[model samples]
Target: MAVSRETEPPAGAAELFGETWTQAQRYADLLSTWGVDRGMIGPREVPRLWDRHLLNCVVVTPRLPQGVTVADVGTGAGLPGLVWAIARPDIQMTLVEPLLRRVSFLEEVVADLGLENVVISRSRAEDQAGQFDVVTARAVAALDKLTTWCWPLVAPGGVLLAMKGRSAPEEVEAARPMLRRLGVSDVRIETYGDLAVPTTVVELTR
Candidate 1:
């Protein structure tokens, strides 16, 4: 089918996605094609889409409480948001994006996948109303600024899972004062999966 820079799914894709493996493939195709064309994903990302993007996001799905509502703030191209929705049908997913172009792309992807559990919110994180069981963001911003924006949307007793890279611990330390002010003492860095570059997530419970 001549997918643009098509890459094979990683060894554990099927294991991670289970019965939704096909849907995940379709989503990958979209990300490789439409997602790149629309500037949602870079062309350089296509070849490693599975490992760096898809798998990186799905591995964190186990952290989500079953059937809980999750909001992915600034979900550009639906990284962890749409990816999580595709992998976990049991939970409700909201992909919150401010840009209309991205929102349009997300809407098309949701409709194309017939994903009934996903919702597209055309608003920025700060403007988004209501709280959710989990509020998440990936490559959105640094811990301090990100927490400032996402903490409000996390319902009391809920959590904010910030997908970070190697700087997670440093970011946590830098944001300590802000985190303490938010009444968030239960913060930890959790790594998921057995991959060489496992996904690192900063989990903060409010």
Candidate 2:
């Protein structure tokens, strides 16, 4: 089946991804073909895969501190996590996922791309031990619940980059009590990229 109306990478994709553009393209191909066949990605998402999925994730790579350990909680189909690993080989990326089917797809793509910077952990975020310099999630859960699961994985002086939608402010406000209880005072809403609707990230520092 045809993935999307726009199968080609959108304009500026190469420049944005820089040296890793080729790997990014290969990853996109996998997402369009095998990813869809395995039900990891919805058929409707194929058309806008480059713009909505790849670009949305890649745009936020600059925020990650250099050469730090990063974990992407519930990184289904490798959204920002795999994208970030492709773009920045400097950082160590751990794609934390619980589903077996998704894990299989991620392993295949990671090997096919020859991405040595990535590690696939087939476990839920809450069950995982150890901490990372930065922890992030996309469409995983609300801010409050996300904290409960992801916060423990964030090391001291680390940050949780929760990619949210237009309702980021509302989610942040609703999670205020939980945030304070967790001793999280440094919460900020930051926008990244020059897209029409920029990526909204709720940065919760630990």
Tell me the TM-score of each prediction against the true structure.
Answer: 0.97, 0.97
Off by over 4 Å in 1: 1-4
Clashing pairs in 1: none
List CA RMSD, all candidates. 2.0, 1.3
lDDT (Cα) of model 1: 0.92
Clash pairs, model 2 backbone: 4-47
lDDT of 1 by residue, 1-206 (tens): 43457768978789999999999999999988898889998888998999898999999998898999999999999989998998899999888999999999999999999999998999988999899999999999999999999999999989999999999999999999998988889999999987779999999998
Candidate 2 versus the native: TM-score?
Answer: 0.97
Q: Which ten residues in a row have the lowest lDDT in candidate 2?
A: 1-10
